[model samples]
Target: MAVTKTPIEDVAGDFHRPAEHDGVALWWLGQAGFLLRHNDLRLAVDPYLSDSLAEKYRGTPFPHRRIMAAPVAAGALTELDFVFCTHSHTDHMDPGTLPDMARASPRCRFVVPAAERMKAMERGVPPDRLILVAAGDVVVLSGNFSAAVVPAAHEERWQDGEGHDFFLGYKFRAGEKAVYHSGDCVPFDDLGDWLGVDSIDVALLPVNGRDARRKANGIPGNFHLLEAIALCRNAAIPLLLGHHFGMFDFNTIEVEAARSEIRSLGASSYAELIQPMTRYDIR
Candidate 1:
């Protein structure tokens, strides 16, 4: 799917909008990134706005080519309560973008897996503002709001070791409502058990099907279309949103394919595709 760039109207304006709903307001920023706002708290996950990867690896075997322009600039962000990085992948943990965002929001805390501590530090993020989390770790943002880090099978668990926490998903809770952002993951048998199948209100997952073609090109992929539906059933997720597509010109699956697959599964009512820059009021 070709990317559709959403113009950044005004960074401050976007963040300071009047509340129209009571639950979580989520804005899809393309790729695996999202800007979530609930009351006074503001958070973002896996934002890759800069075209650094595209420029840096222009001639490399795995170049980061973007399908469209970024919706918002990193410098435009402010008053960020927290930022979450699920892993160290360039697209997810952008080196060029994170530093600028960190500098812009000096007091904002960055929540990442333990493996990203050093990387974050090297990017000049303040140690005091960095919160290293692991699987099963929970960080309470306020009295009724919290975020939980859960293990994700990206290729395999860590692929290195346990102490070095690598891939992860985040379950954001606001009172009783919960949203699970599965950062670039494939399904595992224990996923349902770990997520408490009946507790998930919204589940955001990657739908670029993993296959020999993608692997042969040296690009690791995520869950396929049909697999995504099955995963949603297994997890008992009430609402499922498809992502991890429409960002890259290469190494991505068409959005129509995902939409068609969901419809074919007769899961269209429960699962849907998220377009960039669109906000959904998850209740």
Candidate 2:
């Protein structure tokens, strides 16, 4: 029954917009967490932030200590709309951060997987605000804000009895743009078919420490190195944002290999692989 959290070192929640940046603004809060803000819509994905994460997973944590601090605190997020949790994992759906976030942004909704509803309820995310989506289920956010649930392959982990069968991936649409974020999984055969619909504008993928041989559930990773590139290539996304790296264990492939591979992809522009407390805009 252990939950995860991240430390909020810097509390000032000001984000600077680049002079040349266009359309919606993207703020990265390290690991698999990010904020995509457009007009009144604020979308947050994965929050492995606050001292709660650190305190939850001290020694022999799933991975290890993350190298960065959360860009802002859960209570500090002023304008938040919908919050999405790909699964019930601590890094993706943290116990510490969620409650504070619920308290802070009373207006934001938690769009989560069906399997994770009980966990979110345990964390105090209200019943009414919990929007559940199973694999293949779609939730439209106005004409612009929209999303579809896809299968997140945790094959090795599931086979080894480490992962739950209901873990999910998300395909989100914000106006003319489409983005995909995979919570945690090793690559699966059906990925292309799941993410093939509509021209994907951006893809936020995990290039982190997925090889969990001796760790908690042994759920490894979804897109390790080559598979991550294959996802962007198949999805036909203009930009691929590499996440879930550098936040934990400096010795893992997530910290070492992800950026180099992201830079080497065959897209018009390489995905903006970010470090902690940085923002990348989607035009």
Candidate 3:
């Protein structure tokens, strides 16, 4: 199955429209990025919308340029309630992109890992607007919205000893429904044990499995395609959306193949392969 990539301009109107669903609406911004909407509050998670990486790594080992256009321009984005970053990685928490967001949505609070405070500060995020969180922390964003920070294992344990600030996954709740975004985490055997049984309604996970080639380029990978499928099964997630693909041409999974594999395993109904710049209403 070929993926129909939606042009950024085609769906920019969707972002500006008033909240249509009383529940939650999500737009896939490509590569570990999503815009989650609940009521009047709009939250963007792990948005990498700049070509900074391409310029910085032109002569380096990981020199793949961006292959997709941004869904919405930074200056055009307004009324954003919050912006969340899982870690200090360039692709996840971009320096160029964050400043633009701050300029556009002045009131948006940036939620970042506690250890990466300096990164947020260096990116021009002011003291009053920054919210640093670690694993096990629960933050109430608005009246009907809250997030529970879950620690992530990005290749290895996300700890200071591992040279990472603090990698995290965010479990967000809106009204009665709950959604989990596994930000760049590999599936540990005990993934289900920590979160308990059938806790998630929608699960957004990465399918770019780690390999020697990606490792050689000094890039870390997330869950393998099969691992994502198994995690969805074990966690009992009713709606599974796979992301972290189709950004940089150099490092992307064969998404169509993965989608096919999921169907072959008799789990096609559970998996939702959302294209970039497309919207999905979570009812």
Candidate 4:
């Protein structure tokens, strides 16, 4: 049977609904985006809810076409408390999406890498509402919510003069439950060390493996499916939610085939290939 996707119009409504007690409700919004709800707090990470990439790269060699439509419009997410942009990439910190989102969610704050402040500002995040963070920084949102910033090695880790990372990952703690969203990362030597300390319940990782051809075309890649599973096992994270595929046709693997491979390896107990617009509640 085909899995019935929750309507795109209903995604915002679902996000605004109260979550289960002592748990986090997450909805995959295609690519590396997710809407997370805990208690009354509504948050999103790396939301790419626009076709800016497709519009920009229309006539280019790497035409950025979408395999699936955006699950929800950015303007519809009016109840958002915070949005985390892991890097300055257009897809991660969309120019078309952010402006509308900013206008919609008046009090919402955008968390961005300290190194990409200017880029984020250019992408429509107001300066006063931006919370700039570095790799070693911890942002305490409320008594029950907080985030720890960590470096992301997106192909290579780049740093500024003050050593703030250009790319980042976030370990968000909503009460006792923690979720790590590694924004466009490949495994690094100390990645396990960074994540192991957090006692993460669910890891939202990218499984769009890199290649020479894509790299030559200026498309940086992320973790392979096996590497993501290994990271979960090595870090002792109980669940791995794989993403960053099924959005772009050129950079994606066969989703069903990948799922079958995971099942064959007996890693389904801890790993899952996430589907767009589907909700997963972590208790």
Ranked by lDDT from best down, the candidates are 4, 3, 1, 2
The prediction achieving the highest TM-score against the true structure is 4
175-205: candidate 3 lDDT, tens digit per residue: 7778899888997766676566536788899
lDDT of 4: 0.87
Q: What tens digits encode model 1's per-residue C-alpha lDDT throughout 134-196?
A: 888999987888998888887666734557558899999987788899888898878777787
The alpha-carbon deviation from the true structure for residue 257 of candidate 3, after best TM-score superposition, in angstroms, is 1.6
Alpha-carbon local distance difference test for all models: 0.79, 0.66, 0.80, 0.87
lDDT of 4 by residue, 1-283 (tens): 0112343447888888776565777898888888888788888898999999999999988788998898889999999899999999998999988888889999999999999999999999999999999987888877788889999999888899999999999998887888899999998988877776758888999999998899998999999999999999988888888999988889898989999989999998788888665677776
- Choose the strongest candidate by lDDT: 4
Lowest lDDT sum, 10 consecutive residues, model 2, at 1-10
Task: Show where candidate 2 strays beyond 4 Å.
Answer: 1-22, 59-63, 155-165, 212-219, 254-268
Give TM-scores for every candidate, taking all chains together and pairing residue i with residue i.
0.91, 0.81, 0.92, 0.95
Full ranking by TM-score: 4, 3, 1, 2
How far residue 164's Cα lies from its native spot in candidate 3, in Å, is 9.5
